[model samples]
Target: MMKSLITTLLLITGISMAQPNHLPTSIPQTMSFQAMITDTLGNPITDGMHNFRFRIERPNPVQGGQVHVIWEETKQVAVVDGVISTVLGSVTPIGAMPFSNNFSLSVALGNEVISVSPLTSVPFAFNASRAMSANNATHADTAHFTHQAGHAHHADS
Candidate 1:
């Protein structure tokens, strides 16, 4: 019984140690993703270069959304010990858009589309730009209302 217990403990420890680390919680302009590659037989694909295609999709209908690809790019990535890391917008430009709604990310290895992950947080840079625009508008409004000695303030009404 003691021997069996020791063996079980070692097996659990090994499995825990082999688990992959978590991906980044947030990304800015150049978005990145990390994933573990496994084969059909549940073995880790180690030391390989593969073509990966990434897509940002907008969901249609909102509730039960369909995939509408908004941005896409294909790049060759290196896989080491079943782990692959990639930047989504490095190859293709991530054009500016109003990120009012949540978007989903899809990764394709060669031709097979793997899975879609929901992007919960908006990129910090995009949010910053929006804030800057709001500040500019506020500044303009202040300038329009405040009349200087040499300047004439024209009221719309």
Candidate 2:
């Protein structure tokens, strides 16, 4: 019993001397926010099906801080108030090169989607007030987005 007690005390003291309580040393990491949206049948969604039109001003890159990466199904997409949508944006958090299932991102547009025009699929209007006024509106096409990899980002208001 005395031998076991002494060994246990030594082990605890050793661990206390060696272990760290804080997060790992900070690195200038760039977080990538990526999403792979799929259909109900689990097929990859093409850019042709979406209109991306949202405006965002990214945070000034911090020294030694990981950059945030963002990706979404639409920069701008239709929103209807009374509608329940199954459309979800798949996400990958910052610094993850090969995206996995550790993160997911999702948002809703509005109330009722009476129609979606094939010609104009993008949902974000530069005119925020007017876009909100209209029960339904159009926005930037998803294919038009110039994604800068490794840039951290989120919605602008």
Candidate 3:
């Protein structure tokens, strides 16, 4: 009987440990978010349809440490075997907003909300913003030179 009990306990522990704790380490260019959902009892919530709200928020507020929501959207999602995959920018564009600091993710389902998850990697969109700023600066420099050339007319000669 003790042997049987030990086996049962081991199986339960293994199942509970299988749940994913962090987001993917690689930053995806397409803004796809994937997660595994489980209940408080560590049982996977699978084969269900649910409404999920996702939000990206600044970790530290400009005034205080209070979080500020930068982007949010609600979507009807399908869960298959405890895994959920959704493209974030599909419903609402994440846009070219600058991410100066690492942001946290908040997910709301039903009345329960989880807001402690920090993004594992910097967003691809953040790098894109830097690239755009560099391009704009280059164009501004060229425009300044062009303006100077136009003003350099021959002085009455």
Q: Which candidate is the best by TM-score?
A: 1
Better of 1 and 3 by lDDT: 1
Per-residue lDDT of 30 in model 2: 35
What would the per-residue lDDT of candidate 3 be over residues 1-157, giving only the tens digit for each residue?
A: 9999999999999999997764454444348788888888878786779999988888565667888888888888898988899998788877655555787788887657944587664587567556544422223333432342323333331
What TM-score does structure 3 among the candidates reach? 0.55
C-alpha lDDT (0 to 100) for residue 120 of candidate 1: 73
Q: Over the full model, what C-alpha lDDT does candidate 3 score relative to the true structure?
A: 0.71
Candidate 1 lDDT tens digits, 1-157: 9999999999999999999664344444676689998888878776889988899888778667566788999999999998998877888977765677668888888899876888776588677556544522223234433333233344332
The best-first sequence of candidates by lDDT reads 1, 3, 2
Residue 120 alpha-carbon offset, candidate 3, angstroms: 4.0
lDDT per residue, candidate 2, 1-157, as tens digits? 9999999999999999898654455432332223444545766544433443211112234745332334434434332332223323322213322222222233323332222211121255346335334432233233122132222234121
On the 0 to 100 scale, the lDDT of residue 19 in model 1 is 91
Worst 10 residues of 3 by lDDT: 148-157
lDDT of each: 0.74, 0.36, 0.71
- RMSD of each predicted structure: 17.4, 21.3, 19.7
Candidate 2 local distance difference test against the native: 0.36
The count of backbone overlaps in candidate 3 is 0
**Candidate 3 colliding pairs:** none
